[model samples]
Target: MKKPKKPKRPMLAFAVTEIDDHTGGIVWARTKKAARIKGAARWGYDEPAYVTCRREPWADRFHSKPLPVWVMVANGWHFDCLGCGIRIDEDLPNWQDRCGADDTFRDMLREARRYRKWTPQCVIGHQHSDVFCSQDCKDADDAYRAACKRKEAHAISVFQAKVLKRFPGVTLVTDRDRMHPHAYATSRKRGIVVQQVSVEFEFPGMRYGPASLRWDSPFSSSYRKVEKPYFSCCNGDRAAFEAYAAATRRAAQEPTDRDHP
Candidate 1:
């Protein structure tokens, strides 16, 4: 969990400004422990919000000790794409390129954050960010997943129609929340695969409504087919997918073709 960086505050006399506890004003140092405070004085604070470093005028008195680097420098921040694993130490704003900045970790530092805004497609790559290096990395991980909703919906319409057409009396059962969603299709309440929901078909005395399934392939999952049912984000309906392999194993089936007799 990354915390938001607070806005830069001005220093009064510069002893590593920190929030004062007693006076509810700026304390001189990151913290007593972190800043290694040597000496300090009292304060005159009013209603104190969160422990924030307060800004004060120029110091009319003198301090005994000096402070260390408690602030972020122009080249202090660093980042690696959690998705692509690229040490984004330079500027990269293009989403189409294989590796480039998308402003995920823009500026905790300084120069490279801005100048590179004009300089796209850096020869060597190394940008600064907190977590993900690029926006593409985030999307690849589906950070903002609109999901394969259209595909799932299409499967539902097509498969439901297919099942109903084959047997009018047979009923089709569906529950979006039959299973939990995974990286491919998430939400325990939503039986989704990648972006589509699982489905099922039932006979006159069979179960209808809620069902779950997953069909795995490199194209759909966009990678290796995982054996774990839940881990499989295979695109397509799950209605009877789990039963497919077993059914095939039990019966040696072949495509039948009519010959001209």
Candidate 2:
């Protein structure tokens, strides 16, 4: 019968030792204790300080003793397979070959913490770490958003047409000035401008009732609206509009009592 083969063990490449800050070189020895003693002898001081050195790449420095459990816990260190949550033992020589968990310990810990509460899943039931499972899901989401934008554009165009028919000869100023007024007009006498005019309609969700008309005369910097029942000032009634325009023109032309002799 053939003899059973012994399992191979993993080995660490670097040893922890005190470094000479002046020279930027490691004070190395056969063991950590020996390195410490050598550091004390060279510097004439007894202090426990060490750093990792890779001068001897094949050296098995940390094989004898594993890192302390307390230190590992405090530093939030762990190795686990992301696919199955299986703990990976780095001490085994063939650990990487067995589970393929090659991510650094710190990186694995960060990923675990980030997805602790929820693991993302696609609409089709595929599990993943990203917002969608695959490119197909991402494309579908984009298409849905585009369709919503198109529907909204159609509705706005229909509303704008209605407004144009209702208020002829008025300029439609959207964009930043959407809240200013629905439509605006420039009052002219013999093709020469006299005053600025704007009209606001009473939509379904308006806070106030009836439409409103505003006018900016030479004397005022901003357009002023008449008190409630302002709709009577315009509202496509020729007689009402003529009376309101005449009153405003007279007010602008006449001087106040304060300026009279």
Candidate 3:
């Protein structure tokens, strides 16, 4: 028989900032130690939300000290993409040249900047701080972390060279640690990529909505057999789109509802 795994404990932590739409400040939990709630801390409005960081199993002489590289969100802060794996193919190398007249990357930044203006002005990247992790990891976790950062940096550089061309006055601002905003915008310039709530949209003359939607594409929808792909922001709008469905079912009686019955 296999041994059963033990349940993990919860840790107590604090939120460093007040996220705009979030009801409470974010929290950081350490060591899997749960904290008890008190009057204000336990109250519905004042309840303290927490996030936890697991302690690395290897605590060696090197582990005792922080790593040389900047700390990833895994250590303390929680940074993630709000719109990942959508139809963001335009940004990829293979599909780059396809979107000419309409570019989705622009739409992404614009949409990201609209409501969450606080993202650029204040949100910080993990690289800005001295918190580093051990380079000793000889596993997949280490490789994944490195790759994610590289992807972000490469994307940012591309934005600086290509996207900012139209807007001449815009310039990029980076810290020594390379930590910026999830998506930062300046007086004239804005960030390259940022996370936001899910978005859905539909263009004219499409039957089924696309899994993901982009505002612009270099490809000509008019020339193609299909006009343009449309998308819904949320999954709840399918009923509104029934008319466009390619398939439908009809109820019938015996012998295909023949009048002879």
Q: What is the C-alpha lDDT of each candidate?
A: 0.36, 0.38, 0.31
Give the TM-score of each candidate: 0.30, 0.23, 0.21
Tens digits of per-residue lDDT, candidate 2, 1-261, equal 999998654442333334554211234465555655554554424554533333333333433444332222223322333323333232312333333367787765654553344212211211112223223544755565565445434434433444444444334445435553432222244432323334454432223233444334443355453322123233444454445345445333322322110
Q: What is the C-alpha local distance difference test score of candidate 1?
A: 0.36
Model 2 TM-score is 0.23
Task: State the lDDT at 244 in candidate 2.
Answer: 39
Best by TM-score: 1
lDDT digits (tens) for residues 125-237 of candidate 1? 22222345444445655643454554445645644554444344444655447533222444334433443333455443223332323333333534545332221113342
Q: How many collisions per candidate?
A: 25, 0, 13
Please say which candidate is ahead in TM-score: 2 or 3: 2
| Candidates in order: C-alpha RMSD to true structure | 16.4, 25.7, 23.6
| Lowest lDDT block of 10, candidate 3 | 252-261
TM-score, candidate number 3: 0.21
Error of 3 at 232 (Å): 22
Q: How large an RMSD does model 3 have?
A: 23.6
